[model samples]
Target: MPVGLRDRIAAELTAVIHGGDLKLERYAGPPGDPGLFGIAPGDPVWRVHGQATGMLTGGFAALMLQSLHPLAMAGVDDHSDFRADPVGRLNGTVRFITTTTFGSSAAAREVIDLVRLIHTRVHGTTPDGRPYRADDPDLLTWVHTAEVRSFLAGHQSYAPRALRLTPAECDAYYRQVAPVAEALGAREVPRSSREVERYLARMRPGLRVTPAASDALLFLRRFGRTRQERLVVRPLMNASVGLLPDWARAELGIHRPAAVRSCWDLPVATAVGRTLEWGLGPSRIQAAARGRLAGARQG
Candidate 1:
């Protein structure tokens, strides 16, 4: 039986987003698997990661923010072929995050270990002549903090009210997701909203946009397979920029006016969010994980 037009359209989008690796079946049973952190519909991680509009924009925002750290950017610029293979790079990241979030425990651990092993070989020196390694605890912490902070910001700013996290839930999301970073060998990870802010402030003196990062940002901003896709992505990119802290935005050279943000970016973000919901119809990945957990409970 056909799944219907909406589902087929969604499948295509998922294929694009996951880069043709929609292992939806992997999110299914064998029961008793909660992946890394157990999936509850109302859980902070689930709520934040479930919203497509938020995740997409958040990801772009995070890359922009992450690139500010010279050492972190150094490892990425030297080792990643993101220049020639941006989609491949994106697919790898999506695989790790979605799998760890929704795949079975064994699957999640497997991906985590693979990433750790890959990190072992990723080392280089920044332009300023400081040696950097992907596995460095401090670098890992910076990457993780910047990413989740942007994610939370995106969810708060763009997701529908029903999907948005409360202030308390936002705090919970950070605390809950911190362990994932720690498992990747990050130490002293921030586990609360305030902790993350303080951590970012403490790290500010070392952050800046290098030339390589500038090039990368330009590439991300302009990426899309078709004219239609580019049109859709443009507002989301601007909305992502809108979510950045004033200081971070100033550093990144983003200065969208408040009036434009309210009149244009936010409205477009909302429309896109609804369009995504119409197409994707709640997350199939989250549904599969829920089914997997329900089976365990039934058993």
Candidate 2:
């Protein structure tokens, strides 16, 4: 693509990802602010989240996985703005993740505290008379597990060879990322690869294919602000679908052939990821945080 078009695409994507929630300046001029993780050069969270394609794909898969739990889906179905303003909801989610991941220590905690506050109001009874609360420790753990696991899968599959994490790094990511969920009052949040797998397996019996889940999936497949943006989102969703576990695919009625998923979906998503990486270059927010850390070290 030409430089102008590339820049335009980059701008649009940046707007979509940032949602006007994080200012470029928040990351700058903060000497010695190591942010929440105090991540190093090769921190697993930084590397995994740096891949926009993987994050987008994994995020959608997380939604799908979360929708499997009727209680979780019920909370979103009743209280969330997903149907009326899907993009806006997406923008908010992007804001929270980016802020918590790349913002300064104060900024990161601010978003987390805001989310915890919001969760206090997100309580209701499900259609089947079951009660659900966003702050419920078990529910929080389920959401956290589904989300980060999906993200790791996306990065492991789509990120460049040099950036793709090894098994050890994958384990490291799980161990390191549990604190955010813990802070939100999640109990027994999984902290390793084996633990996560076992947790998901243990929770499978409680999952279902409710009408709300189906509607949510349909809306996700079709959501975008414009025709152009929608076009770009299609392959990303396909790649996300490809990332789902076999039982999840069956539950969601996803019928794509395995070979097509491996051959077509992965390649298309990889190409899109490369385009994003080239267009976006380094994430501005992360750069600012890194500068702050370097400034601290130098000081």
- The superposed Cα distance between candidate 1 and the true structure at residue 11, in angstroms, equals 3.8
Tell me the tens digit of each residue's lDDT in model 2 across 1-299: 78998788778777777764458665665788877866645789888876788898999899998899999999999999978877678888877776666667787788789899999999999888988899999999999999999999898888878889888889999987898788888989898889999998999899988999999999889978799888878889999998788988898889999999999999998888788778887678777777877887799
Provide the lDDT at 270 for model 1.
Answer: 76
133-242 per-residue lDDT for model 1 (tens digits): 99999999999999999988888887777778877888889888888899999999988898999999999998999998888888888987778778878888888888
Show where candidate 1 strays beyond 4 Å.
Answer: 1-8
Clashing pairs in 2: none
What number of clashing residue pairs does each candidate have, in the order they appear?
A: 0, 0
RMSD per prediction, one decimal? Answer: 2.2, 1.3
- Compared with the true structure, all predictions reach lDDT values of 0.84, 0.85
Candidate 2, which ten residues in sequence have the lowest lDDT sum? 20-29
